[model samples]
Every structure is written in C-alpha cells, then in structure tokens.
Target: MGTQERLDPQAGVGTRVREPWVTVVWNDPVNLMSYVTRVFQEYFGLARHEAEARMREVHEKGRSVLSSGSREQMEIHVQAMHGYGLWATLERSDG
Candidate 1:
C-alpha cells in the first residue's frame, strides 16, 4: 500500500466540506400567499417581486430557503417564521 493511502483511505478522497444550513419555509393551508410574501419582504427586506417569487417557489416546490447560515441564524429565522404562523425548519444540506 502507498504511504498516502496508509494514513486512512478516506483522507485522500475529495469531499465537499462546507456545512450548509437552510431556513426552509413550507406550504401551509392557513396563511395566504400575499401575507407570506409580505412577511418575507418585512423580515428579509426583499422587494415585493422578490418576496412574491420566493413565496411562489415555496408553494410550487413545497419549500423555499428563507435564509441560510450557521445553525444559530437558521434557528432564529425558523422561530420568526413560526411567529408569522408559517411552517419552517432548519436542515443541514446533505451535499
């Protein structure tokens, strides 16, 4: 066996190392799309069109990344989303 391989078989292999956490806003039966859009605009400072686009993405795609960062930040976003009566969660990306 080569010296490089002896260190550990996985060590020499390339892999994506960044941790990606996302604040996912889910589709809900109660909140209106317009309200969701407004909340996104208010919290994220996104324009009306941008907010609406994101909302539509959530409705069609089942979820949208409302924010992304460290676990702490994602938690805050998820909590805020809940306060607005929207379903949200934080998940670490598998990639």
Candidate 2:
C-alpha cells in the first residue's frame, strides 16, 4: 500500500479542492411560485426574469442555489431565507 493510499483510501490522489460556500433554497408545499419569485427579487435584488427562473428551478427541481460566496454571506442568506418562511441550507460547492 502506498503512503497516499494509507492516508485515506476513499480520496483519490490529486483531488481538486473547491471550498466555495453555497446557499440553497428547498421547495415546499406552502410558498407559491409567484411569491417565491417576489421574495427572490426583494431579498437578492434579482431581475424579474432571473427571479422567475430561480423560482421555477426550485419548483421543478426541488431545490435551487440562491447564492454562493463566503461562509458568512451564505449564513446571512440562509437566515434571511428562513425569515421568509422558506426552507434553506448552506453547503460547500465541491460536496
């Protein structure tokens, strides 16, 4: 067994590392599509079309990445999303 393999067999050698944080909004039964779009616009200041697209993504795909940035900013976004009564979480991009 090689030294690299001995350290951790699960991780392949020379793995690319990405540490960006992302704020994800999950779909739920309560919020309407239009309301979600409006919330995105109001909170993130996204244009109508962009907000609509994100809202649709959440509606259809069950989740949408609302924003990506530093961990502090992502945490703020997650809290704001919670304030709006939306389900949300933060995760590393490389997941």
Candidate 3:
C-alpha cells in the first residue's frame, strides 16, 4: 500500500487521519418502540430516558445515530443490531 504523508503544523510530523464511522438504526415496522428502547439499553447501557429518546428519534426521524467510533467497531455494532432483528447500518460520519 502506498503511504501518503503530510506535515502536521502542531506536531511537526506526519499523522494518519481517518474518518469517524457511525452506527445508525433505522425505523422498522417489525420492531416495537419499547423493544427498541430496551435493546438500546441492554446493548449500549443507556439510561431509560436516553434510550427512549433515541427510539423516539428513530420513530419520528426515520433513523437515529447510536454510536460513533472506528469503522470496525461500527461494523460490529451493525452486525449486533442485525442479530437483534433491528435495521441498522454504518457509514462515515458527515458531522
């Protein structure tokens, strides 16, 4: 693989930069809102309110961003969500 280099003004050394990836859950007719919230709580350890909020966002907005990190982690999350029968995907975060 070819390595690209750029001078870092702050560190004065080349650093590899990678785009952040995010796990997004999409609304689906198969899953109930309470079940979605429960899954978020069980998998992510989110508080009840936080989980409910995310579920609501998915219900109203058609999608909700659940987590963000490396591409590998995001992919793992997507797979896990699929295991739970929830519609999910990962992509490079736009913001």
lDDT (Cα, tens digit) per residue for candidate 1, span 1-95: 00111333557764433446888999988899999999999998999999999999989989898777767778898999999899999998654
lDDT of each: 0.83, 0.86, 0.90
> What's the TM-score of every candidate structure?
0.78, 0.78, 0.84
Better of 1 and 2 by lDDT: 2
> How much is 44 displaced in model 2, in angstroms?
0.6
What is the C-alpha lDDT profile of model 2 across 1-95, one tens digit per residue?
00121333576455433447899999999998999999999999999999999999999999999888778889999999999999999988864
In model 2, which runs have C-alpha deviations exceeding 4 angstroms?
A: 1-19
lDDT of model 2, residue 24: 97
Best by lDDT: 3
Model 2 error, position 64 (Å): 0.6
lDDT: worst 10-residue window of model 2: 1-10
Ranking by lDDT: 3, 2, 1
Could you give candidate 3's per-residue lDDT for residues 8-74 as a string of tens digits?
A: 9999999766546899999999999999999999998999999999999999999999998777888
